[model samples]
Target: MAETYPVLQEAEPFYFEGNDIGILVIHGFTGSTQSMRDLGEAYAKEGYTVCGPRLKGHGTHYYEMEQTTYADWIASVEEGYQWLKERCQTIFVTGLSMGGTLTLYMAENHPDIQAIIPINAAIDIPDMAALQNERETRFLDAIGSDIKKPYVRELAYDKTPVKSVKEIVMLMEKVRNGLHKIQCPALIFVSTEDHVVPPGNSQMIFDNISSRQKRLVQLDNSYHVATLDNDKELIIEETLRFIKRS
Candidate 1:
């Protein structure tokens, strides 16, 4: 039997209608829409239609996350994309951490995406071998809310399910292999001192993606959750600029 968990506060999905340009905002692994609401609202303020989908098995509980697969998470994003497609002429996708990996996945599978902004995306997990070997551990310490800003925290799971971690690794492998298939303009961001995903992941993504129009930016004052960190404004501003030019 499957266990059910209640959704956490401030973790509900959000949608804002606006102009023809649609922006799909995705949160990271073990995270909820709360981590991306600020960015979504900013885009909405700029007259861009925004949709922030709550990924399956997330925003509820780590136990629920363990029951989900990467395919389920991708399906959540696909539903959001299709919703936007129905009403908008142009679409842009951006995400944080695992969300960023999904963004790349979308770009690879759907060429209709206008551009992408991946913030601190994970590609190569340096300790993946170790994680894979640990068969007994069901969960690990929380990897969320890596923000440098004081008093600010992301709405993410306090524990990470090992099963979900494996799913993300599988997704990363798939996305990495399909990098060449992503030809849309891209803007990648990496925090200089990210505690979760290493900065090198962004570099590898930049070098592998076939996008001719791509830029890599470094956030000096933030960490992995840059969207909710001190440099949140920078991410919002730069993303808007990237969308306009792309």
Candidate 2:
């Protein structure tokens, strides 16, 4: 990273209710806690300790992430793990996109997680990876550094580093390699027609996870970012049920 990590202030105040229920809602790639704000508030209103930490190298200068690796991203989630330990007796973690990959990583590594919910979670990139030709496209741009940019919205910022995309792909590989290790209850949410990460990504997790109580939900009217779409409320309700059961 180009600059030292800033001590980001918490997005929402901690609601200290007596309820021991808790949730850690993680956002998608290049997204901040803002994307999960509504869902976080829904859980918080129910007196759950909802912690949504901005992943490393996100919600800031994208160029600063040129050197950042997926390891840094996982470290950010680890910090959230420590923060939530004392807040609730049982903790549920849920994430979107790359966030979902990290959630599986956590659930696989940390057996103590009460339950896990991955919304439009991406794992096993080669199955249905993002971008048509991301590696070649990114490499050409990097070599020239003067090539006309492609993509939209994100390209409006500093173009995604080729290395960063590779790192995310590596993250997917790591998560896929450890999929069967996740024995905890899992609620996998997927959009039937996700433009970013396809539904196969979710199925990969559902197929590999050993959780007997696991489930998969196909969301319509939503693309890649289901956490912010109309089906979010259903996700919230179903997740609450899964957490209670587990």
Candidate 3:
């Protein structure tokens, strides 16, 4: 069995509220809180409080995750938001992939976020019409039986719930229709050739968000996991700039 990660019964505060800056790192679907672990440490070292919460139904069996909905995941983020609110007066949200989508969702409602950084976020998931027609494809069993790839893209041992995936695609549609309402300082990063998330998602967000301070940086190396990809530096640097500016 794989060893569990920084096992914690309660959420860990990344820093003190008295410090004036805090960060909440949200992980992607089917991914554990550890996806933002390295970034959390980087924030903590820089004297900012950071908390990366495990989304609902993650860090365990994949098949068991099917029961969770997007709302459940949002609740987890809300809990982190409340927790960080206690100590840090200002909190910035950042996420990878599905995590990024959640961050945007949170920032949409919570304007207290100083800045929102989306790493490899898909504002719109392409091939949705195609995916809907092919939902019955054997993604789970194929995922389960296949050996872990050498590229360190090992999934969280969780299965993708078709319903959950459907919900994500639906959520993307909702955001696309209401992008004008999001007015926070947004920083979006896109992988030119990301296989999982189409590049247009980032473009749409960059083009639609009403914030003048927003920026979109293109990444060539990191596929979907910009947190751990070769162009991860650009992520850290750009994020740091947003944190400092906000």
162, model 3: CA deviation in Å?
A: 1.2
TM-score for every candidate vs. truth?
A: 0.98, 0.83, 0.84
Candidate numbers sorted by TM-score from highest down = 1, 3, 2
Measured over all alpha carbons after superposition, the RMSD of each candidate to the real structure, in angstroms, is: 0.8, 5.9, 4.7
lDDT of 2 by residue, 199-241 (tens): 8888888999989889998887566666666677888898877
lDDT scores of the candidates, listed in order? 0.93, 0.73, 0.71
The reply for model 1, stretches above 4 Å from the true place, is none
Best candidate according to TM-score? 1
Write candidate 3's Cα lDDT for 1-246 as tens digits. 333344333223243333657788887766666556777877777788777877766766555466667788889888988888888878899988778888788877887677899887756776543565555653443122111223555345435666666667776776567777778889888887776677888888888878878988998766676676677667887788778886
In model 1, state the lDDT of residue 179. Answer: 94
Off by over 4 Å in 3: 1-18, 128-151
Encode model 1's per-residue lDDT on 1-246: one tens digit a residue. 889999898999999999999999999998999989999999999999999999999999899999999999999999999999998999999999999999999999999999999999988887753586678999999988888899998999999988888888889999999999999999999999988898999999999999999999999999889999999999999999989998
**Error of model 2, residue 168, in angstroms:** 0.8
**C-alpha lDDT of residue 192 in model 1:** 93
Q: Who wins the lDDT comparison?
A: 1
